[model samples]
Target: MAWSEADAARNRELWTQTNADYTAGSAPAAWAREEMGWGIWQLPESQLRVFEGIDLEGLAVVELGCGTAYFSAWLAKRGAHPVGVDVTPAQLETARAMQEQFRLEFPLLEANAEETGLPDQSFDLALSEYGASIWCDPYRWIPEAARLLRPGGHLVFLRNSTLVILCSEDEVPAVERLVNPQFGMHRFEWPDGGVEFHLAHGEWIRLLREHGFEVEALHELQAPQDAQTHEAYDYVTADWGRKWPAEEIWRARKR
Candidate 1:
């Protein structure tokens, strides 16, 4: 189904409230962390090295579904010209606040990642840590990312692994065995009126190719031994993650 403005508004409303709750949680530390972390487990980029070999200096980076935009702040510190885009006003507000707290300044736009209406071929890199990767439909946002990037520009995003999705039902923690079919997985409706999208591995590869992106890597992420499960992200236990991939990062270069 197409992601309509109403759907975007609902997601915005959902995250606006969620962002308020994050103020009392780990969100603050995430913004100010010495190193970049990915996903619920906050796996260190130092070990994963997702962005290594790619120079960030002076690159025009656009972060789709940027939420609080901590990643953008990191990119800015590394000398990239970063712009954060999100549909949730509350999230963008917090992002703005962080820019001040860190004494860093970058553009933050209140816009949907699926169709940002930004200029074509305007960015050298498109990033979505957990933002558009889960919240926006890949069919929509992947194309938008391609259109936003200059030729050979990169796109990187992180999302829940398909294993976690197949092993769990709505709001329940993931189990050891598959609970859902793999073939027709895409749009998922949660009990809290939240809609998330997940694609099979093959499907993601195909979609990225369809959008003029050459698949560079798919890093199925394993939780470190010392990784702790937080109450906010009770979907998958740390043990389960260590045995099976809980999150993944996809890297692609626009053709």
Candidate 2:
């Protein structure tokens, strides 16, 4: 859905609330943090595993909307020169602090995903896990992503999709439900539960095509194993294993 000025205002407020939480180092609930270990939530373990199998030791990479710089941190650990960009300064600050704390050398920048301040063809790979979808205009951002990526560069992203298999409403924690209703094949929720938007799968493919990306791969991923703790694994796997596609992952290359 198109965002009205009022919608933008509401989104700003919601993001502000989320950034405040990040600044406060508010720990994501067990499930949210669980993704960190297992690659659910916004973490991209599956993609990272794929990256590890290849040679990325010297590539210039950018993680768009890199909240907390988790992925950037991961890449840096692997010897890639990575930059983390985000629209929220609070998030950037948190990411920067984490980098410093971990002695990670990655750079963090504050910028909009649709219009990053970086120069053209500045990166060999632009990765966005659960970030680009939330932008005000993904169509605009897709080309920006392409522009930032050099010719033959790649864009790896994860998006919420329509074909998701849901966990039992009872299994998920209560606070997470605050944003649950906003997410699906059709809708999205911001951090504060203050705004919702309609987003669809076709829009993602069309956006990539319009921006000069050749689709490489797109598919649903199984529920992240670490997203549920060991104790809950049996129950979660039994209930959601067959059904739950935790999210969608997309891979594309600049053409």
Candidate 3:
């Protein structure tokens, strides 16, 4: 199997085991239908204004790694047509259950984010919130996203900052000093059995441009003052997160 295929297989197992824990938290259950947030901090979109001038209604949106797909449900409620794609069937199962419970329905596909097997130029916006952004290889999945979008379509995603990844390794919390070298950073494997991808900001800009995307903006996410404690995400402490960005949102447009 290819690296991504192996990652997909591992994801199926890891997510299948942890999906219930997600459902227990503010995931598919307590997430507000009207509100939209990004990352584990759940920072308010209104405050961040990631979509300041973009109209969402009536657009075809594809969420790359929508594990449980609460973001898709939120988009559906806002009148946008959203299709969620994920590798784990267990995650999609929970998403399907939420669709019925919330009365907000959208299509969900079980596929690798790196190659969704969907038609090209079919989406107006592509989104991922700590989903494909971190889990999939940027070198492959980004081109896939570009292929899946029409000219002028947008690509938005949230992932950990390169700084955080360089500061820490595996499942460990970020330290005060840089523990890893930044040169040629790409793939990361955790000792606990999982994989992730992080790239430098300069690399990201170049990648977006090379793939016919116009770099729009990069939002370095500061943890909200009232950000609730999340047991699942302990990679950054509230104090450290408040001082430096632990996560970021990248917004780009197909050109």
Candidate 4:
């Protein structure tokens, strides 16, 4: 059900510890670097196709709520001056180590988006893939992103659509209920432990406008027919994946 004070406290503690581990050399949880084909960098290849064509050379970029800084590193490799920010020191530490291991250099900041204190219009672009956009409240973040960018700067993001997540179940009945009756995202709690939230299609679009972003494009990841699937398929699929335009690859500009 609902998040408890104890649960939030424990999550905060774990998040802190995890970030520390990241900074100290332990890999961030989501990246799964040890896995054979599932490295976090796989993002820019497919989910972020738009970035494939952009010239990032020498641009000042920030990876907000960057978990392991993989995206930041990737941007740096493309000649962008990428800076990564996250709430967990451990994760930043892991990012630092990764930077050293790869002979890459970029800055990392430990701060929350709601109060980053980074200079206004400091960055030319902001990139976040499955990190800050999904877990944190965008109601506060839209302005923070706007504040971080110049008047014409861009924000690129990827997030699971509410519909894709709800229809992930194999049963036709459940899928029908999600698509027809409910037609929205559901807050789910894991059996092992932990609670997560999701946003609906209209809600996402509304939040962007509320924060003053001029929406450029929003659509699905559009997996190929022969694309590989994650093991979690048995549990849930992102609503955006069902077509019907669920989850999104979003690009917006500060007006």
Candidate 5:
């Protein structure tokens, strides 16, 4: 189902609260400096870098749902002209603070990912790591991303797999048995008024195709049983990730 305005408001409120809560601590800054990872497993991007073949130097890139703009800043450091877009002002504030702290200059826009006012075909690449693609409705954001990208431009995002989404519950740290059916499970409502999104693998392919995206790669990230669990992400366990895919990365190109 498409998210209503009420759902948008609720999600905004939820993220606002979340940003405020995280801002009270210093962990986010420290974690931002750590290796780039997909999810709780925190698999190092150095070994599985998504932008490996793509040249980012002087490219126009945009990061959706860039909470602290760390990834965008990283892109800027690589010589990409980066812009960070987010809905929550608090989060953008955090991004601005990080910009100052790191002495990097980048624009951070307070805008919803689903309807960012960025010009059409304005970006050479778009990125989201555990960001807009996971929280916003893909039906909306996928097309928005297509609109933003130049032809042949790439869109890469990381999100929780449907397997993980099915097995988890809001505010619960452990990944137990499946709590929801796989088929037709698109929206997950949290008790705290937050709404998240997920889709079956085939559904994602269809959606991307419909939005003028050519599927390039789909990676299901798994962790080893001995891999250390990320203390910050309480929802997923190493054992569970070892047994099942916890996160997925999608690499697509605007066709």
Candidate 6:
């Protein structure tokens, strides 16, 4: 389904409340502080090593749906000039707080990821860790990301797998069985007033190609048997995730 302004507004409210709730809670533990992961699964970039060969020194990077801008802060610490954009003001407020806490400086803009209004070819890398690519329509953001990146620039993002989406339902806590059809599943509306986006694997590839991107790699992240359960994602039980792909990371280059 095509993304609408209504969907955007709803998602902004959902994330705003989510950030506020999380902030009101206790501080993160040492494990969370050290891992610096992407999502509820908390897959560490240190282990995936997707950015191994890429040089971030003095490079320009843009992070879409940059909730608390933690990854953007990480990029800044590594010498990259990073800009974080999010649709929700509350999230940006938290991001600003994090910036102060980390003693890092970077621009954090409140804007929709599908239409960032950033300068053309302004960034060397576009990143989203279970962010815009999950919340915004790919057809819209894929082209926007293409416009934001210089030639040969890369776009790397992690999102939930189609299998997980099909098996899970709104407000439910576990991946029981395939509750939705595998084909023609695009937009999902949650009971908590949030919206999510997805596409079949082939559709994603075609959309990326249509938007002037070269598919480089696709990583299917599986949950280890020893994976610790996260309170935020009780639906993705370790056993269920081990049996099926829980997340996928896409690496595409702007051509």
How do the predictions measure up, each by TM-score? 0.96, 0.71, 0.95, 0.74, 0.91, 0.92
| Regions more than 4 Å wrong, model 4 | 1-48, 168-197, 232-247
Candidate rank order under lDDT:
1, 3, 6, 5, 4, 2
* RMSD after CA superposition, every candidate: 1.5, 6.1, 1.5, 5.4, 2.3, 2.4
Question: How would you encode candidate 6's per-residue C-alpha lDDT over 1-255 as one tens digit per residue?
Answer: 444688889898888788878742322231126446655666788987778678989989999998887778778877999999999898788777766666778999989999999999999999998789899988788899999999999999989887888888767655667888878888888777888999988899999999899998888887876887667777677777777887888888999
Top-scoring candidate (lDDT): 1
* Model 6 weakest lDDT span, ten residues long: 23-32
Runs in model 1 lying further than 4 Å from the true structure: 1-3, 23-25
The 10-residue segment of model 4 with minimum total lDDT is 34-43
Shift in Å, residue 75, candidate 5:
1.0
TM-score of 5: 0.91
Candidate order by decreasing TM-score = 1, 3, 6, 5, 4, 2
lDDT of 5 by residue, 1-255 (tens): 445456667777887888777742543464356566556666677877777789989999989988877788777877899999988787788777777777888898988898999999999999998778888888888989999999999999999888888888778754668887898988888777778889999999999999898988888898966787777665787888888888889999998
Cα deviation of 110, candidate 3, in Å = 0.6
lDDT of 2 at 242: 30
Minimal lDDT window, size 10, model 1: 22-31
Each prediction's Cα lDDT score? 0.88, 0.60, 0.86, 0.62, 0.82, 0.82
Candidate 6, residue 79: lDDT: 90
**Residue 54 alpha-carbon offset, candidate 1, angstroms:** 0.6
TM-score attained by model 6: 0.92
What lDDT score goes with residue 23 in model 2? 35
The digit string of per-residue lDDT tens for model 2 on 26-67 reads 422321232233334334455545343345788899887677
Instruction: Compute the lDDT for candidate 2.
Output: 0.60
Candidate 4, residues 55-138, lDDT tens digits: the string is 789889978778778777766767899878777666676777777777778888887654578999999888777656654556
Q: How many clashes (backbone N, Cα, C below 3 Å) per candidate?
A: 0, 0, 0, 18, 0, 0
Residue pairs with clashing backbones, model 1: none
